[model samples]
Target: MTRPKISQMEAYMIETLRASGVTNEAIIQAAKEKDVSTWKQINDQYDFEQLLVLAEQDFSTFEEIINDGYAVKFVTVGGLERLLKLKFQKVEGKDFQKLKTGVQGLDLSGSSLDELKQMLSINWKITKNNEYVSVLLKEKKDFA
Candidate 1:
């Protein structure tokens, strides 16, 4: 990853860890080790609570997007992850029906299909009815 991307991910991780009541010392340690692998380790170890919080926030944002009839075409891994989380939650069939109701559709782009699949822990057999989210495995040049 590039320096700025690493920095952004670091900042995001720090904010997430802080929100989840992680200790300042741990945060400092994470900050001291600034690299993609280290960040992934920190995220894997500490991102559960924050991911739930972010998923809720993303759901609210999606609600607004649907309300205002916004045609969303998100071109970021974060966006794709948000959608995937919602989709996974919905598939789990636990108090997530409200998300699919009155929804048109959205386009979600990520770095690679394989990369995103690797991030998923569960086997999600998403069907056509659950096609509210359209996936776009975008090349790096498209982002540039």
Candidate 2:
């Protein structure tokens, strides 16, 4: 069967839900319901209002990131570029000078949340904003 054609925004929302630990079965059931109960589930588990705001902000930004053409990799607000910067922050003993000229990027999809936080080097909290970022970081298959 053919897959349903979803907009970038819809995909973003689905991914965000997945990252926030919403099971695919639950999401599918919610979509089937297509009613207030679906929303209630989200509101019960998270700050739904805040999630909407972050999703709106990330919608267009996510499009731009996809167009950069690094394959189907996901990232937060800063996107792939930001992810790359964080991944390479460690200058270490190998080829710092070569890295200065140019560096091959690693596949960031494999990074765990803890690893991502370490790369970001901030007092990372699991906020709505972070949840949206996690959306981009998650594989599309997660929603499928």
Candidate 3:
């Protein structure tokens, strides 16, 4: 017997539902009925929206600490990978490789702070006070 094919989105949704403890029987029933409302109803029980808010808050706090002359170093790939896993829960090795490749392409070896800031294409202010260098991201108006 030939198996029914499902779209990538459908597969992803089914996997998510399964991971969230929805049974295979329930998934099959939803598929047969052509109704994803059951999956949506279960999904609505989770606080994913609040999770996003909390993640943003945490990132802002980290950025603030970096801006305050506290160095946040990722000394090893393993350490960075672990942090990514903690923040995202699931990050594939290929994704990390792509990220590393993109970062490596930046090539900031010979660039000065101003050049690096320009290359980043964001409103970043670099403040060097005697011993410490602080990089802060701000709005264009703040820079002006």
Model 1 scores a TM of 0.22
**After aligning candidate 2 to the native by TM-score, how far in Å is the CA of 35 from where it should be?**
2.5
Per TM-score, the best of the predicted structures is 2
Model 2: pairs clashing at backbone N, Cα or C within 3 Å: none
Winning model by lDDT: 3
Superposed model 3: Cα runs more than 4 Å off: 1-4, 33-35, 42-90, 93-96, 99-144
Residues 1-144 of candidate 3: C-alpha lDDT, one tens digit per residue: 112222222323434555677765554444444455545565664433332232245544323322221222112334333422332233544332323312111212223433333322234344555543344444468856
Across 31-100, the per-residue lDDT of candidate 1 in tens digits comes to 3342224335445764434333432445444233222212222224443344334333222223223232
Worst 10 residues of 1 by lDDT: 1-10
Q: What shift in Å separates residue 132 of candidate 3 from its native position after superposition?
A: 40
Candidate 1 wrongly placed segments (more than 4 Å): 1-15, 18-28, 31-106, 112-114, 126-144
What tens digits encode model 2's per-residue C-alpha lDDT throughout 1-144?
A: 112232333434444565556765555444334332455554364443443443355544433322221122222343323333333342323312112322222222334433444333121222223222321232356445
| Whole-structure CA lDDT of model 1 | 0.35
- lDDT: the better of candidates 1 and 2: 2
TM-score of each: 0.22, 0.30, 0.28
Q: Give the Å shift of residue 124 in candidate 3.
A: 38
